[model samples]
Target: MIIELESVFNTEGLKLPFDYELDLSAIQVSGYSPIAQPVRVSGKVENKAGIVNLTGNAQVIYTAPCDRCATEVSKEYNFPLEHTLVVALESGENDAFLEVPNLRLDLDELVEEDVNLALPSKYLCNEECKGLCMSCGKNLNEDQCNCKAPVDPRFAALLDLLDE
Candidate 1:
């Protein structure tokens, strides 16, 4: 969806609502594409005294395995969206501005960028996940392992002192 903002580019108190579905499969983070469904972005763009502002929410259903236990984890992200739209800037290096090329703003691009920023770097099945036992290769959450963790050689002397 390319928003036609030329009408409201210079008008104050003018708002135009835009809807778009952001495809996030192209980008991968942490060896997984978290988006199981299309990221729905519904919001509006307003020009306030020549400043084009986009405000909305990007929502998606993320399904992936937990970082620790390898169990399936699902998350719904309704990320708040706020962006500054500009026709042209002195420099394109700044991250703060979203350049509106040819008098239009790409809604899909904006939503993708916003959702990327909002998603968590790490996904957890739960806060207290015990993960897998190193020795037995068993999920600790499901069953306790009988294999004891081997003591490091550096700590062997101190451990022997306790045994004495």
Candidate 2:
């Protein structure tokens, strides 16, 4: 969705509202598509005292397998989209503002970037997720495993002293 901001940029106090659904099902995160539903974006671009700003919210439901236990987990996320729109930059490079060359803003692209940054680096079923046991390959969260971890040779002397 390309939003033409010609009027908003020229006229002070002018506001351009936008609401749409963005399809990002093809996006891959950590080798899987977690976003099964369309992203809901609702916001407005307005010029306040000659400065144009875009503000909105992007809502999505992400469903993916947990990183540790591989259990499926569904989570809802809402990311606030806020950026200052500028026609041109005064310096060499600036990350604080978004430059619109022809006064056309790709709303979907901006929203997608915000969603990706808001997503967690690693998804887990729960905070205290006890992953599978390395020895027996059993889920430690469901039940305790009988396999005893191998003791290092350096720690063997400490174990013998405790037994005596």
Top-TM-score structure, candidate number: 2
| Local accuracy of candidate 1 as per-residue lDDT tens digits, 1-164 | 77888887868889998676777877677777778678888889998887888889888888888887899888887998887888887654587777786877767777777777877877888889888765566888898888888445468778778999
> In candidate 2, what are the lDDT values of residues 2-101, reduced to their tens digit?
9999999999999999999999898898789999899899999999999999999999989999877888989988899999999998787577699998
TM-score of every candidate relative to the true structure = 0.80, 0.85
Best by lDDT: 2
Worst 10 residues of 1 by lDDT: 150-159
Task: List RMSD in Å for every model shown.
Answer: 5.9, 6.1
Point out where model 1 deviates above 4 Å.
Answer: 91-93, 150-164
Q: Model 2, stretches more than 4 Å misplaced?
A: 149-164
Question: In candidate 2, which residue pairs get closer than 3 Å at backbone N, Cα or C atoms, i.e. clash?
Answer: none
